[model samples]
Target: MRVEEIMSTPVVVTREDTLVKHARDLITRKDVNAVPVLREDGEIAGIISVSDLAATHFDDKKVNDIMTKMVHVVLRNNRVVDAAAVMVKHNVHHLVVMEEGKVIGIVSSLDILKTMVD
Candidate 1:
């Protein structure tokens, strides 16, 4: 299967200026592990994850303050195995899925595991 086949779509994203508390709430409500931080011009700036939030004490701070600037991404057309490889190589749990230079979805390690189980 392809990354797009199992990736979560309609990605939930956040702005750099968004409050940490808000981002955390968004993640909890959406049941996602992370969200991509986007620039005003719609480009990806960084990423914020549940682990990032949990490791910090800045609920009132901006998302940018705790976001990981180096975001790993996978093309939507890539194979699921390729996505898993990226995750393993980067020691990351999630990756932003892109298509035509635009954020389209996200894939997590758990997603890959679910595919294998099914």
Candidate 2:
């Protein structure tokens, strides 16, 4: 399967200036593992995950202050196996899916497992 086939779409995202608490709330309400943090120009700046939030205590801090800046990404057309390899190589659980330089979706380790079980 390709990444686009199993990736979660219409991704929930947050802005750099968004409060950590708000981001946490959004993640919980959206039932997502992570969210891409966007810059003022709508460019992806970083990614924030549930682990990141749980490891910190800066509810009032900005997302930019805690988001992981070195985001790992995979093209939508990439194979699921390749995406999994990237995740394992980087020891990451999530990857932002991209198409034509634009954010399209997200893939998590759990998503890969679902594919295997199915």
Candidate 3:
């Protein structure tokens, strides 16, 4: 299947200037493990994952302070296996799904795991 087939749409996103605490709250409140950070131009700037927040001791840090700027992304039509490989190669758990340079969805490890399970 393609990445779009398994990716979660209507993903929650955060801005670069958003406080780390707010990012943490989004994760906790939405029960999501990560969120993509978008620039004002609607481009993917970075990604903030649970591990990113957990790694920092200071809660006052901004999302930009802890967000991973070297975000890996996959096109909607790319094979799900390709997305999984990127995650494995980078030791990341999520991949931002983009189309025409705009954020559209997110693919998580669990999503792939479920595909395997089913």
Off by over 4 Å in 3: none
TM-scores of all predicted structures:
0.97, 0.98, 0.95
| lDDT of each candidate versus the true structure | 0.93, 0.94, 0.91
14-84: candidate 3 lDDT, tens digit per residue: 99988888899999999999999988777888999999999997778889888999988899999998888
- What's the TM for model 3? 0.95
Question: How would you encode candidate 2's per-residue C-alpha lDDT over 1-118 as one tens digit per residue?
Answer: 8999999999999999999999999999999989999899988999999998998898999999999999999999899999999999999999999887788999999999999999
- Residue 103 of model 3 has an lDDT of 88
TM-score (C-alpha) between model 1 and the true structure:
0.97
lDDT of 2 at 70: 93
After TM-score superposition, what is the CA distance of residue 51 in candidate 1 from its true location, in Å?
A: 0.2
Best by lDDT: 2
- Candidate with the greatest TM-score versus the true structure: 2
Q: Give one clash count per candidate, in the order shown.
A: 0, 0, 0
lDDT computed for candidate 3: 0.91
